[model samples]
Target chain A: MSALLQLTGVTAFYGAIQALKGVDLVVNKGEIVTLIGSNGAGKSTLMMTICGNPRARNGQIVYDGEDITRLPTFEIMRRGLAQSPEGRRIFPRMSVHENLLMGAYGRPPAEASQDMEQVFTLFPRLKERMAQRGGTLSGGEQQMLAIGRALMSRPRLLLLDEPSLGLAPLVVKLIFGAIRELNRTTGLTVLLVEQNAFQALRLAHRGYVLVNGAITMAGPGAELLARPEIRAAYLEGAH
Target chain B: MVRDAGLSALVALGLFSSMIGVRMTQGDDGMTLTGRGGALAAVVAAVFVGRLIMLAWRARRPAGTPSPKRVDAGLSRIGRYVAPVFLIAAIALPLYGGRYFLDTGILVLTYIMLGWGLSIVVGLAGLLDLGYVAFYAVGAYSYALLSTTYHLGFWTTLPIAGVLAAIWGIILGFPVLRLRGDYLAIVTLAFGEIIRVVLLNWTSLTGGPNGITDIPRPTLFGLKFNASGDADTFATYFGLDYSVTQRFVFLYYVILGLALLTNWVSLRLRRLPLGRAWEALREDEIACRALGINVTITKLTAFAIGAMFGGFAGAFFATRQAFISPESFNFAESAMVLAIVVLGGMGSQLGVALAALVMIGGSELFRDFAEYRMLIFGIGLVVMMVVRPRGLVSGRTPSIFLGKRKDIAADLVAQGRG
Candidate 1:
């Protein structure tokens, strides 16, 4: 199958400092493409760049065969690209239900309720805390809510930034299980950025290893997991 | 502790200087500096005594009072009844109130309408608009000019004035689209001053500082309130004795109806999609954009709608007085309305009205205090701020919820985050 999203030599900057330099990445349809990296390796930058926040100063971003390199962030979001941003930036004052409604802001109200039900079915914990304020949730629950809120959009492509960050082992497992289930059941295309290298590679269909601002390696998930260089650099002692 | 006392002494000195030392007079000596040494000493003594009392109080109190759980959930339970009670009392005011009370009621209602209008822009949309009086001015002038030049009645000019102010609101909203917070405030303040200056300089059109007088008063469905030989005088038509107080009562009901309409519209809009989007934008603009909300349009609609209401209040102000003047729409007027919104809990309609009654009505109550009234008002405001930093009735009920609608603690919401 053809690629769902294609990025060619995408370079992004924060003022004069370059965060993403000459990055080329692709995610095929119905596949979970994991990008594993250490701290400050441009993972979040790439995700934001795709959403046209800090717009790609050079090169192109193609999503579903359309060049969305210069579109506004809301326009990109309207085109079925949703991101559960780093640090779980949920509206703290808003309730979990309101946050979910915010996610489906671009969609029809009728379809949004159905999407909400699907999200609740995936994350039952969120359903229980539907009335709770987003800020009042635990880190793991907030992470779940962030993901669930993004899913409320029913996007064709989901960009998750550090979903496993600061989560307990069991909560991490639950989150990964949810991601896998979403991919398997709905054929959802996912571009996951993770610092938890081993679990990410094991879960992804294909994997790319990013160091500094560039991707150094790309292969099948199992092959990347087996590579000694990746094993020592990222997966070592990171069960 | 000694350093803290010294700092407090300095603050007391500064406060006394502003409050008592300097005065402006309209004489050969335009400004005068009076050395109120006794007042300064008194202020310093008061501060030191206050500090000592606070220290002693803290020392006597238990160490672990559990931080007083700033969230008074019970207060909101009581607060739910405040609006209904106040509404009932306000409706019955004309039956038993004297002329002075009725006038104060009209004044309080006008401020409440203005407060509600500003609340939409500042409180709901998170846009600090310091020059909201510009819209009020626009509305007042629109009605004033329409009535004087075109001989349009109050009813005919009301909607026209509102639309005209809304258009001006849109015009002012454009340049400030990229501005936020303090920057937005400065621009809006400048816009308000610009309107006042234009009115002052445009003598032919606006009558300059002399203002437009003898503007027609509102009639009750084409029936004049006078006993004069008009086609249908209200007193003659109804076969009642013509009393000047009847006009004041009619004006009271007119403003009460207008204020109620403002309240109803604002409360209804708060639950709509646009209002939710506004709150979202206030919370996080980037997140709002990510959610595909058009932030610019949201902000503009808030401005337009807010200005529309301000216009309605201004038109009513003109009709009530049957006169209009630039002096009536000064920066102090803007500050007064903004104070009402802030002193009322932001985003709470009931709070705004309550604040208006207290601030405006309370000022009227202290009118006998003469020059000391402002000092008392200032002290009262400081005390209120210290007691309830988030204004009275700060608890927020979420616009949308799934299960039971619990009141979100005022302390829980990050101020200026939304």
Candidate 2:
């Protein structure tokens, strides 16, 4: 399988403090790759760096076939990389439909509507709250809208940052099931960052353990889930 | 409830004590102080009564009913009818009202255009622009210079002035691209002062502090409003009396047409893709960038389009007065326009119009109050802020809605901080 996104020796910093320290990772096409890490382990930083926000201090980020390390955030996004960022930063003032339209920002209206229909099919709850402002939606519904909004872009590579951050277990299960189903049916490449290691490892085809801005272990999902170290560090005392 | 009212009255007394209670007049003795005990008592009593009424009103409401949202919706429903009635009244004003009324109408309409123009930046796009009068000055100067030097007609200079202001808007936009919130407001405020200072000092070109005079008045399709009653004059060509009121009426219609065009364009833009990008940028800049929208271009367009309208209004001001000056585009003018946008609902077009009427027309009516006009205006604004902090019409109508359309509650809509 070809690598959809390859980050080699990527480094990022917030002022003087380094967040991503020479991190190397790869996400192949048509695969669900999970990066499980504790809080402040540079998971969100890696996601933001991939989108060219803080500007990686070193290393190359190649997405699809082109190098996007030096590109602006919007330029990188225009190349079909969509991020359902941390905290589901949806447009609070806009309605759910308008928020989805914002996701399909640069696309032709006809194509956008078509993709929006596909999104609605995936998250029908969004259809019910079509006219409601995004801020008024419940947490689960907001997560669905955020993912659905990402899907509206028709992206080849979807970057999700902490989808199950503050969700109920049942809601987490529902959201994970949708992600798994999406990957299976459409061959959509996903790079999911999550603290829910057990479920992320279960849903992902492959998994990487991020420890303090560096990838310490990488292997097939079942192998990582079975490893004593990963189980102790990320999966201990949790279902 | 009485305790709360007493506490508020105490705070008001503390605030207004020095401002109202003591008066230092230029007496025979140097700055003799006098006490206005009666006025101070009246102010404190009024505050006490107003606080009591507000607390009583809140207590009267049932808990958790969301009555404010319903009231907002009702107000907006009434707002729909108000726009048409106001427009009709404006159209018919010249027929019955004398010169003073027509003049006030002209003044109010100019501000409505100015308020609407600033609304696109501060209201919709969420960019705080205290330097908006800079663009107005640009437009005014463009028309003044173009008409004086090249001998251009008002018809010719109008578009030129708008384009020039838009260009200046883009220029101002580039510097503040990374600024937000208070930083943006301060930068824009400085920009206004910079333009005024430049216009004041650039004596060779702008005529310095004395300002430009004898700027040509706008003609009606090349027909001059001359009392000579020559064949080419409006009086002779239209077979009418050459009253000065004819020119005033013509100028009135000119601003009305321009103001309507501004309103039409602003309303239409709220639906367009560029406009959507602006609202989206205002909602969340990070989300907008993630969606592949070029924020630079989005911000620049908001500025350019907003400034373009300011320019149109400025051009009108110059033509109407037949004089242009740096004094006209001061920081107070910028603050006044910003006040209209804020006092109205930021993004609501009709709210801006109503706000302009209250601010400009109400002040005109209060001209009889002489020195106390501004004091009354300040008190009214303070009361408005205390009662309705969001705005007069704060509920937002969603640009696109599905199912039964409903207005978004004011609290749900995020004001663009920058």
Best-fitting candidate, scored by lDDT: 2
Q: What does the lDDT read for residue A200 in candidate 1?
A: 96
lDDT of 1 by residue, B1-418 (tens): 5566667878888877778655556667676555667776887888877776656666675665523444557667777787789889999999999888899999999999999988998888888899999999999989989998999999999999999999999999999998988999999999999999999989999999989898889988998987685659888888888887888899999999999898888878877778877777777777776666777788899999999999999999998888888999999999999988888888888889889989999988888888988898898888778667777767667887643323222222333211
Candidate 1 pairs with clashing backbones: none
Fraction of native Cα contacts kept in each candidate?
0.47, 0.64
- Candidate 2: C-alpha lDDT: 0.91
Q: Score the docking of each candidate (DockQ).
A: 0.42, 0.54
Task: List clash counts for every candidate, in order.
Answer: 0, 1
lDDT per residue for candidate 1 within A171-230, as digits (tens), equals 999999999999999999999999999999999999998888899999999999999989
**On residues B69-184, what C-alpha lDDT tens digit does candidate 2 reach at each position?**
87798998999899899999999999999999999999999999999999999999999999999999999999999999999999999999999999999999999999999999
